[model samples]
Target: MDHPPRIYCYRCRKPDLLCICADVTPVPTRFGIVILQHPQESRRTISTARIVSLSLTGARLFVGLDFAGCTALHSHLAAAPGPVYLVYPERGALDVVDVMAREHGWPDGAPTFVIIDGTWAQARKIKNQNPCLDRFERVSLSPGAPSRYRIRRQPRGHYLSTVEASVLLLSRLEGSEEAFRPLLEVFDRMIDRQLSFKSGESRRGVRRPAPRPEGG
Candidate 1:
């Protein structure tokens, strides 16, 4: 039997047909971003955390559930030039836009936004397991447009992908949406390509073989 062809895009680490690296552009930002990604999310072909890291200059990506023992994370957090805030939707979390407005464009100082990249359950698990995250101020996004991550169905209508959340946060902080709009455009194109691939698979009508009888 002939093996399948291996055509991979080294930059994105995705198969050639699903690669979006050529369409991406890295944007500069005043605020720092730290993405704590669950190990499982990092392996997904459609993971947006990688896109987020690639799109933003100086953004950091760390993979794991427990960061309390991570000296790198501790050092990064400690060296942050300004305040550190966790982007989460916990009960006491404040709306990020509101927080920014009240401070008059981050008067306290530009913030280092830490985002947890994972599914809802995985994100919650990371938060629960990582004691180091407790030291940061928690922030949430105000109700806005619905998520455009069409390939994956979210449990709720309001839950945005990690990249979407990051884009919104950055747009709001900069007081203009144009800077981060390219990331959204890239995300949209990625979804469209994936959907087309799925449609092609459906048209091809690939099916599993039926089980044989126990008594042949």
Candidate 2:
């Protein structure tokens, strides 16, 4: 009889579903994260949402624009009186920088970040797909360090993987350099583990190795 099929950990790629090496500690914060993931991206095994969800307390991940199935996000926005800033670059005729500067002095409260979670091209598609989002103030981060996401290629320097952008924003807003450090570390470690696994699998002439026995 054939053995049960092996399953990879979605986040860590380990034979074990839950990796003990990965600490599931919590970060204390009140900031809310609104992740708008493209449908294709949402199903990928290595998407950044896994890390972002584990890192923040008020994190909400949504697959599309309608907000129909994303009840949590809808409720958050409906109840929130503060301004919502779409974290995307300004396109032709869409000047986010100007709006951000003008709304800087709003008396009510701090701004919430709405990140578009996809590649530069995919993100642009998201923006184009959702015209209702035109009114939101787009808060683009000035170009900086290159992304640490090794799997995907980005055009020139116009791209930042979602996690990198999140860390930068959190650092600037909350004044915490360590805001998303753990998540970044986890990502780096995951890459290293995946690379090692791939190298071994290549040598064995198989796509995947026999999984370690359960409780072994």
Candidate 3:
């Protein structure tokens, strides 16, 4: 049983066969996207957080369980052009669109969006551990098109993948659906590839399901 070590693409951190590096077409965004990904999720082959980071010029990915003492986190917060906002569904979390109307609209810079990329439980853990994030207003998105993440079992229909949520958040916030469309393009491509990979396995008569990592 001497299987060869899998060669990985450093840029996308995916195996060369499943690499998404070629599909990454960077999309410019008006607001900053800071994705705080749980360390475990970073190691997953189908990480959409990587796609969001790769496809958006304004996106920054930080991998950690707790960001309490992360220098880059603090520096990013300090350097935000406008108010900082956390995109988590919390009690009384305002709607992203409504926030614009309530504040009479941000003519210049919209708040930087901090998206926690993990399962619901893991997301809660990250927020609780990062007390610094408590200072920011929490905003949630109104559900859009149903999640296209059919590869996993989601608790609900609106439960989106990390990049799917990013597409909705950015497209709506910037008032241009077209700009963020590329994020989904890459997201869908990844899903298709994974499905194809599994099909190939099934053709060889593999019975077990592939592991599904939680994100968004």
Q: Pick the lDDT winner.
A: 1
Q: Would you list the C-alpha lDDT of every candidate in the order shown?
A: 0.86, 0.67, 0.85
RMSD to native, candidate 3: 3.3
TM-score of 1: 0.88
Clashing pairs in 1: none
Of the candidates numbered 1 and 3, which has the greater TM-score value?
3
Better of 2 and 3 by TM-score: 3
Candidate 2 deviant stretches above 4 angstroms:
1-21, 65-71, 92-107, 207-216
Cα lDDT tens digits for candidate 1, 118-195: 999999999999977898889998647788898998888889999899999988888779999989888888888878
Model 3: lDDT to the true structure: 0.85
TM-scores of the models, in the order given? 0.88, 0.76, 0.91
Best by TM-score: 3
What would the per-residue lDDT of candidate 2 be over residues 37-122, giving only the tens digit for each residue?
88767655556765676666777777774544656776776665567878876653324355446657456765667898876777
- Model 3, C-alpha of 152: deviation from truth (Å): 1.4
